[model samples]
Target: MEKKHTIAITVEDQPGVFTRIAGLFARRSFNIDTITVGKSEKQGISKMIITVIGDDRDLERVEKQINKLIDTIKVTEMPKKSAFIAELCIIKVAVQDKKIRDDIFSYAKIYDAKIIGMTDKTLTMYLVGESENIESYIRLMVPFGINEISRTGVTAISKDW
Candidate 1:
């Protein structure tokens, strides 16, 4: 049975490194659910948090392949129970009437989402939370009509030692 897996990878910061990693995924036929990369604490190195869906054997094979890459320094699987995971979502919802606007604002407050911007016709909200919370908030706004959504896919780190 397949399951979701989040892998944290540390690699040397260099051109073509992302391409190589992406190519590896494509070649192996693994679909990446989300990938977030940024500079790590160490200079000249970068970290990537990638989420994928596959069985244990498949995940093992992919990790081994990633470790073979020249730029790869370390690859570690972050189990949800042992990781602090989050995703960011920016959503613009249509504000058609006073009641709708009030309702939307109320829902945002309930979810602790920030109202980043607003105009006569729309309200833009910024929310950062677990994937499930993000999805739930989006669902609540559907009745109000969503104008646009931009999500920074899952980024995570291991829990405290």
Candidate 2:
């Protein structure tokens, strides 16, 4: 059975490194669900969190392939039960009427989302939560007219040190 896997990779901070890493996935015909990269705690290094759906065998193969890349320092596949994962999402919704805007605010409050930016034509919200919670918020915002959405893919930490 196919399962969702979150892999965290620590790599050298060099130009085209991301391209090379992504190429490995493409070469295997894997469709990445989400990918987020940022500077790591160590200097001249970066951390990448990638979420993909694949069978256990395929995931093991992918992990091995990633390890062979020159720039990759380490790769860890987080265990589902022992991982604390969260993602950030920003959603822009079109709100032309006052009542609709108020309703949106009410929903945001219920979801613990913050109205970070707003204009007569758009309302931007910042939400941080588990993947499912973010998806749920996006689904609820659909009827309000979602203009655009930006997400930082799942970032996970091991529960045990």
Question: For every model shown, what is its TM-score relative to the native structure?
Answer: 0.97, 0.92
Error of 1 at 2 (Å): 1.3
Q: Write the per-residue lDDT of candidate 1 for residues 50-149, one digit (tens) a residue.
A: 9999999989998999999999999999999999999999999999889998998889899999999989999998999999999999999998899999
Give lDDT per model, in order: 0.94, 0.92
Model 1 alpha-carbon drift over 4 Å, by segment = none
Models, CA RMSD each: 0.9, 1.5
Clashes of each: 0, 0
Write one digit per residue (lDDT tens) for candidate 2, span 57-153: 9888889999999999999998778888899999999998999999999999999999999999999999998999999999999998999999988
Q: RMSD to the native, candidate 2?
A: 1.5
Best by lDDT: 1
